[model samples]
Target: MRILALDAATEGCSAALIGPDLALSRFEVAPRRHADLLLPMAEELLAEAGWSLHDLDALAFGRGPGAFTGLRIAAGLIQGLALGADLSVVGISDLAALAAGARRSAGVNRCLVVNDARMQEVYWAAYDFDDRDEPRCLGEEQVAPPAAVVAPAGEWYPAGNGWMAYPEALATVHAAANGPVAAIHPHALDIARLAASRVARGDAGSAADAIPVYVRDQVARKSA
Candidate 1:
């Protein structure tokens, strides 16, 4: 089964294709350019695999609790591509993607995924693989001050920009945790991998049903 996935949920813009034998991807940390860069990156990756949107069995995207604009951009693109291609789509969590990334890169079994959400808060979640070996969220993903973030007891490898943005605060909260792999950002490669698992279980939804998850409802703060 071939799957195409894209993510623009943070400073990064990334696209990936998982073909029968090989995986191809494009990833870059280009903040203001996700809107301009995502589609071209998707096209290039598809072209490299000698495929098109029609050839994909499913399309997937990050459904997020990160930048509101970035989440919308990715969801909009995924919706269009899936609609045009008449393909099913899956929405993978950016938090879950971060967890998967930590497992792949550092063999971390427990992960605390946090992305700086501006306004002195973060989008954070904790994850550990289940007996089925799929990453399972420990609790609801949330947006809160680093100090208010609750983690499951035991060790966790910290991942994402939040760790870098407020290291002292996060460290105070998760001192028992081993890392600050702050360089990691949600990537479509991991999104694709997670989506592939969902697809195998017949869990993909229709293109028209795709929706972005912005945990923070209001895009702008009211004057205080």
Candidate 2:
């Protein structure tokens, strides 16, 4: 299966292509240039694989609980690409993608992902990796002040810059198990891999179903 994935939901922007035996990717920390960098990056990755958009079986992207503009940028790109290629679309959660990064980097089975929500709050979620290598959401995604969000019961490492933003609150949560937070952001490679699994299970949606999962629209709108 040939799959293409893109993520522009934070300071990091990335595009990746996953073919039968080849995985090619490009990532950049261009906070204000996701709109500019994403497509060109996609073009480059496709060219590297000697494939075109129409050759892809599916398109995937990081859907929010992230920066408003960044989320829209990713969704818009996926929509256009999916429509043009007449492919199925999957919206991977940005927080889940972060958890996937942590799982890959730390070899952990459980993770707590928190992305800075930019209003003295965070977008948070708990994930447990099932045997099938898919992340299962343990709690509903939410936007909350760090102080009010309690850690899930069990051994789970924290990830994302949200903990860095509110060290005191995160420190309390981590004190239970004291696992180190991963220093990596979500990558398009993980997004593509996860989306491939989902697409295989008949879990894709139509292009019109492409939507951002903003935890707090009010905060997102204010930021926009």
Candidate 3:
């Protein structure tokens, strides 16, 4: 099945398509530029693949716990595309996508992701790759101060910028890692892969379900 996915939940923004010919992707670390870049990236991928939004079997986006604006941008775009095309959509977790990248790039089984959430807070989650190579979140995703982040005991690989964003606060958390990889962000490619799985399993949602997931809901709640 053809799947198109986009991510703008961090400084990094990416768009990816996985289907027929070959996988195509565009990514850049352009903070505050997601609004400008993400759409063009998606259009380019679809154009290069000679497909339109309607040709896609499913649409996917990083439903997030990262930049509030970035999350909204992606969700709004996904909703428009899905609704216009009358297609189903999937909301993949940025934290889960980060963990999937860790497994794909480094073969790490366990992952702990803590992305900067601003205001001295972070979006954190733990995951383990099962034998099927699918990432399963160890617990619910959360947003909290770095020192308040709790991870299950294991040599989980440290992923995301929170490790660098609040080094002193996260030192103990970092010390429990199997090894440190450079700070990383979620990618649309991984999001597509995860979305494909969900779509195949009949778990894809309607266009109206394309909504941003702000783990720390008070701010979003107030705005809503």
Candidate 4:
């Protein structure tokens, strides 16, 4: 099946198209510019592949625990696209995308994904490459202070911005770790790949069901 994935859940904006025999993508690290970059990037990728929205089997996006505005932008765009094209949609976790990105780019089998969740907390989850070479979630994805994150089982490679943002709190995790990935963002390519796996397992859902995974409930402090 062919899938088009979009990710603007963090500082980066990316779009990818993956199929049985083709893969194409466009990515950029653009803060506050995801609204402008996402659709055009998807269009360009589709044009390059000589395929249109109607040709894709599903649309996937980084349903996030990253920037709230970025997550909304991606989800809104994907909702419109899926509705217009009458396509199925899959919401891939931003954390999972980071894990998948690490495995694809760094060849890491075990991944510890931690994204800065603002308000002095982080969104984190653990993953291990399965027999099928897919990142399998090893534990519950949660939002907590960096120090509250427990180290996952086995030697793990860390990825995402939280480690860089809260080094002291995450210091202990680094000890039993393999190392850090140079650059780790939830790329659309990995979102597409994970969505494909979901599709293969008959897990794709309606466009209206494509909701963002904002792990935190109270996103902001109560007004004084």
Poorly placed runs, candidate 2 (over 4 Å): 220-224
Winner of 1 and 2 under lDDT: 1
Worst 10 residues of 1 by lDDT: 174-183
Structure candidate 2, residue pairs in collision:
none
How does residue 12 of candidate 2 score in lDDT?
92
The sequence of per-residue lDDT tens digits that candidate 4 reaches over residues 1-224 is: 89999999998899999997898999998889999999999999999998999999999999988899999999999999999999999999989889989988888878888889888899999988888888788878999999888778878899998888898988987677877663478899999999998999999999999899898998789656
TM-score of each: 0.96, 0.94, 0.94, 0.96
Candidate 1 yields a Cα-based lDDT of 0.88
Off by over 4 Å in 3: 220-224
lDDT of each: 0.88, 0.86, 0.90, 0.90
For model 1, name the residue pairs that clash: none
lDDT of 3 at 138: 90
lDDT of 1 by residue, 1-224 (tens): 79999999999889999978888889999999999999999989888888978888999999997888898899999998888889999999999998888888888889888899999899999999987667899988988889988767888788888988888888776677776573379889989998998999999999876788889766799779
Candidate 1 TM-score, true structure as reference: 0.96
Better of 1 and 3 by TM-score: 1
What residue runs in model 1 are displaced by over 4 Å at the alpha carbon?
A: none
**TM-score winner between candidates 2 and 4:** 4
Weakest lDDT window of 10 consecutive positions for candidate 2:
215-224
Model 3: residue 87 alpha-carbon error in angstroms = 0.8
lDDT of 3: 0.90
